[model samples]
Target: MERFTPTRYTLTCVASGREFEDEGWTLDDPECGEPSLVRARYAERQLNVRDDAYGIYRFCDWLPIRRTLRGSHAPVTYKSRKLAEYLGLENLYITFSGYFPEVGARMTTCSFKETEAYNVCARRAEGEERVLVVASAGNTARAFAKVCSDNRIPLLLSVPEDNIGALWFEEPLDPCVKLIAPCCGGDYFDAIHLSNLALSSPRCYAEGGAKNVARRDGMGTTVLSAATAIGEIPDYYFQAVGSGTGAIAAWEANLRLIEDGRFGNKLMRLMVSQNAPFTPMYDAWRAGSREMLPYDADQARADAEAIDAKVLSNRKPPYSLHGGLYDALVATDGDVLVATNEEAREARRLFEELEGVDIYSAAGVALATLIRAVREGRVERDKIVMLNVTGGGEERFRRERGNRVWNLRPHRVFPLDADKEQVVRAVEELFA
Candidate 1:
């Protein structure tokens, strides 16, 4: 039997509308100064689902990668009868992207960020060997560490010391992965700043945050999975946003599904939520502006610390960027909702009681926002709704997996205000 090879796709700038070959891990177009996010353009317009394939690979035709990773882990969607009844909604689909074995969600990192890590690593593997550097509060680092380690891909992760607790894994750490934490009182943004300084070397490459087309399309699989499970696109898509990249991915995926002509033409209303006190995107959307208003740094840090969902505290998100969260919201006529820490806690308890599974704090914020939307009549009870539980199943996973989180210590921990020379030296030593 001949091996089935997926067609290679081209990268097109969302701003200039110019196309480029998928020669390597390209993030931006040099020709356009304000280049928008790049998208994968495949020759196959209609999605050809491979029933024989597992997880997100089933939608390989849409993803940019030439091959699929060797994992069945992907977002699993199912009709939520219990939660729907509790919220008084007739049609509610839950896309769980965590370690819920009952629903077939096997993301051991317990976050949808795993989807991005797998796709990004696969895309970069096609090119010359180079170490990938990532900065995260917690979940993203864990996701990348797991995927890169499993694939034997070299990776360096920078995270805040406070968030180091969230970097546990079910299995032992791979030798190919290196970790760095800043001991000085810092936040996620500070970690990103340190990572940027470290990436000055030619051998190190940034994971490209929202700028990376592979990461966005990889995350788009959640929408595809939900649509496939529900047999059609939902009327509304709900998620808790830090960078709003996932929401943007859903909008992009919805556009592709609509182009397929199999799904309904209606665009899914993007109803994204942010934890309160640090709701930059929410404030911008409420004010009818694309630009995020300047926020006090100290106050922002305090707000971020106060929230249970520390992952949703990105101060410098891709909200105002071209073809970013702003464009996505405008294109889909989306609304940003805010959830307080108290509300998120209450919602988490309710969801655990009703759904019989523990959800991450960020997912709790999303659930609270959905309930608020239903109460405010922003979303009709009968309309099809897809709620993205971006992370969950940590407690259940610990119970089943013997609470064995990888305890590999960091290669080094730098001060919060580390100089550029210090960061460069650390990167050099990491490779040496």
Candidate 2:
């Protein structure tokens, strides 16, 4: 008889077609000399949701982590009654990842980014000395801060100063997690640059945004949860993406579920959306170009500033990378859509009124796109559809626990154009 084995997933380079073991945080195979997203190939070929495991760890068979973290919860997937009826759909399921406790969502950060933070941070070596560095628009920062703080993992976060308001937490973070921001009016890209510059310090390591298999596979758990609840793959999957990492994760999960042979072997059409005025992916997809069209930096910043959902303002996404969002969309016959602020606000209101929970603006953007798809006849009424509510319950969470929730204050702020030496020195001071 064969022995049971867990945590036996290998990393596969999409570009080089080579498989290798995971060495902590290897985002790409440098030997291949090509930039590509590496995928996790699990040893377990069959779908096995561990009954003993809690939260995201239930899908531990497919995740690329050796251990699970505390306070981690999986996305709550349920067939919608009100939202589905209101949309006049026979099969609409909602995979919600947020703080709607009534429906079993306990993501304290009120975002699915917790999925990334828990898996990514857990992937670190047991005795790693290097400080994990993360760059975020807002939600990612809060998610990482919360997980790293709870587990006492040394972490440094960089976020745009304007979006710092999103760093609210259930309680004050521990000292192990520190935050910094770009002072001179920057966007998510600027936050990435600041964190990248901080990487000059030997003590710092990059979180590897869209390149990290841990992050993608963690986010992929949403689809895993949905598939488990639905008993099969859906006809369409919808999400709002800034970097399109979540959508790519869904695609990867779809492939894995198909391979498992228990779930229906069908590719769900990924209906991803971006907030209007900052819709780079939508523009590129509509133009039928694999290469993203050039949007001037100044104009992108202007557009980013104009959007209500600030998290969806990523100027550069993973669409053009090998085995990235572009490849995933093409393989799934997906389409990118856009939603205006007015449309998104209305969508949020509609969803909250019908579904009995408030959702984030990014989630609103996703629902808005679905609304457009249905009205335009892009999606059939009888088709099975899964809507990924990436974040929500902030209004409820705040209303219930506002007095106890604390803000994660910045440890330091640097000029947007600060050189590497200056940034590294400031970071060194934090650990000193």
Q: Across residues 58-139, which tens digit of lDDT does each residue of candidate 1 receive?
A: 7778877755666647788999989899889999999999988887788878899988988887677556477899999899
CA lDDT of 187 in candidate 1? Answer: 82
Candidate with top TM-score is 2
Q: How accurate is candidate 1 locally (lDDT)?
A: 0.87
What's every prediction's RMSD, in angstroms?
1.6, 2.0
**Every model's TM-score:** 0.96, 0.97
Q: Compared with the true structure, what per-residue lDDT tens digits does model 2 show for residues 80-168?
A: 99989888899999999998988888887899999999989877877888899999999999999999999999999999988999999
> Worst ten-residue run, lDDT, model 1?
1-10
- Give the runs in model 2 whose Cα sits over 4 Å from its true position: 1-6
